[model samples]
Target: MDAANLDRLVDTDRVHRSVYTDPAIFELEMERIWGRAWIFVGHESQVAEAGQYFATTIGRQPVMMTRDEAGGLHVLFNRCAHKGARLVGEGAGRADKAIRCCYHGWRFGLDGRLLSIPMADGYDGTRFGKGCPEADVQPLSRAESYRGFVFASLAAEGPGLVAWLGGAASSIDNMVDRAPGGDLEVTGGVLRFEHDSNWKFFVENLNDLMHPMVVHQSSSLTARDVAKAELGPEATMPPALQIIAPFTESYRFFDEMGLHAFEWGHGYSGGKTSIHAKYSDVPEYNAAMEAAYGPERVAEIFAVNRHNTVFYPSATIKGPIQTMRIVKPLAVDRTVIESWTFRLKGAPDELLRRSILYCNLINSSANLVGPDDQEAYRRQQQGLRAEGAEWVAMHRDLGREEDLGEGHLYAKGSSDLAFRNQFRAWKRYMAGVA
Candidate 1:
């Protein structure tokens, strides 16, 4: 498509439905957007010990994350240089010192260096034995880690990981800082779910403040009712369930907190509230935070209640419950969500329990709230396949976003500034620029 046509395909207020439904566009996005962007791999804690490895994908390419003998992480393509067989199978496991290919007995070091190939005499006189770098596993163009989360880019050039994270960086910091030891570790196994809708739908849903009350009404109401029955005299106006219930509160509540959108299509919305004060269900957590960070700092940490922070095309970090949902787009209408929960290392057990409960209740594949949202996304994809509608509305707060420095935009929480800022970055990346 031409630049002008692509430009017209997306507007400040609405986007053509083809952006979500077109197979060709999805393929282009996999190359232009996912290839160049710094995509989040598994956490560093997953491969904490030397020789531990986790296999994952960056864009369409299968890659593996391994720890070198020198205590550094390396991300390399999973395919073997000889015979083109995948060196490791499709899961996380230890290479036990060297990665041995099951197909041909070719062995490689933890750092993707070619070590041996069983029959050394076959090519001793040829160019194969002189230690060619080409014979080793190929490495990603860029690999970096922030705090313990690892990310890799398939393309050779782009913004650094920190620069790409932008405003969403604070969400991660807050998540780790809330822990008593100021460190976080991935404890719970990831919950993977398949969605029969475009990945963009999930991305848009992350900062969508309007749908929660309506989409999550059943769960929110149930939570409120349960809380009321359990604590007769403790019910408040904006109950704890309201936070998870999606749309329990009016737009005015979300609007007051303000939203910030950053350069790389990442954004955050929703008001800040204290979970410890709201529920009072985890006193041990509150006590640990207070002991480690003092009462004021603990209060400050819990008070920064963000709903969902989007990390562009890949990840969503929910601060309140310390939940992260990473998106892996498979096709035009297929996406896989890998949900992980973190425990604050050295914190009280109750804190970890709370995180686990939140993950189960809301973020899990079998959650009441997620299925409802998934149904909506499914119907949206079906509807978009029709011939009637051509564009999706993003007109909520058009032209209202204030320009912050370094390509950042900010507005009230209820504004659609996040969507607009996202498209701004999307257009730039899709056009193959910064």
Candidate 2:
């Protein structure tokens, strides 16, 4: 699409329906946004061992992240140079000393350099390897890691990861700072779920406090009732019950809490009540944090009880629970979410157990909360297909937002500030400005 069409698709307060449903716009997003943005690929803990590789995608291209023999990280396109076959299957595996293509036996090192080729004599005196860098599995233009979270950008030029993160870097810091060792690792496993809707719908819903009290009412109420039945009214609610029941909170609570929108479409919303504070106290975990970062710092870290932080078009990290959901867009109408739980190094086992329980109850495919959202998003996709509506309104407290300087916008009411902020970034990315 031309710049004129991209401008018409999004605006300050609303966006056209075709932005979510149009195939051509989706392709452009893959090219202009995903191709250039620093997209998360995997965590360093997943590939800690030498020669270990994890296959993932940057936009529509199939790519793999690997650790070399000396433990250096590399991100390369997962294609054989000889016959264009996939070098490795999807998922994690050890490449041994080198990667050998299953189709043609072309070999590559962990850093994606050409190692050797079978039947080498067949190319004798030929121009096979003459000035042919493309004959090796291609590496990404840039790859970097910040506090163990790895991201890659296909374009050669852009801001570095830290610069791109801006104020959003604090979310990553908070996640790792809670650990006594000041580190976090992706543990347990991943819950992979697919939603029959545009990927943007899922990202927008990460901080959409308005919908939880409505779309998730049935699941939240059912969970509350079950908790009341199992435990007496005077008893403390279990951590899982604490997480599931919060969706039924009043709109006033969310309004009183604030939303912080940062640059590059990254933003978060927090409530006054801390989700972790509701659970039984872990003295050991508390002591560990205190010893590592001192009492004042520990208290300050625990006080930032953010619900969810959207890392732009890819992932949503819930810092309070140490869980994240990564979105992979397959088509205009199909998207996959990989839910991950983290283990805080040097923290108590109970904290990790609570994180796993939270993932199972709210983020997993079979969970009550996730399916409710998936169904609503699917219905939205279906409704948007009809020719009745042309625009989706994002006017809740639109003109009332106060610019807090340094790319932050704040509103006093329950607002669509996050949606408008996201679309602004979307417009910039699609128009090749961001």
Which candidate should be chosen as best, given TM-score against the real structure?
2
Residue lDDT tens for model 2, 1-434: 79998898887889999988999999999998899888999989888899899998877889999999988899999998887898898778898789989987788889888888777777778777523687778899999998999999999998899988888878888898888998898896689999999999999998787888899889998888888888978878877787788788788876766787888898888834533445667898898888899999988988888888888988789887899999899999999999999999999899889899889988999998899999999999999988977999898888788888988777653799999988988988888986
Best by lDDT: 2
How many residue pairs clash in each candidate at the backbone level? 5, 0
Worst lDDT run of 10 residues, candidate 1, spans 272-281
Evaluate model 1: give its TM-score: 0.93
* Each prediction's TM-score versus the true structure: 0.93, 0.96
Provide the lDDT at 27 for model 1.
87
List the lowest-lDDT window of 10 residues for candidate 2.
271-280
The Cα local distance difference test for each model comes to 0.81, 0.86
Off by over 4 Å in 1: 226-247, 274-277, 294-296
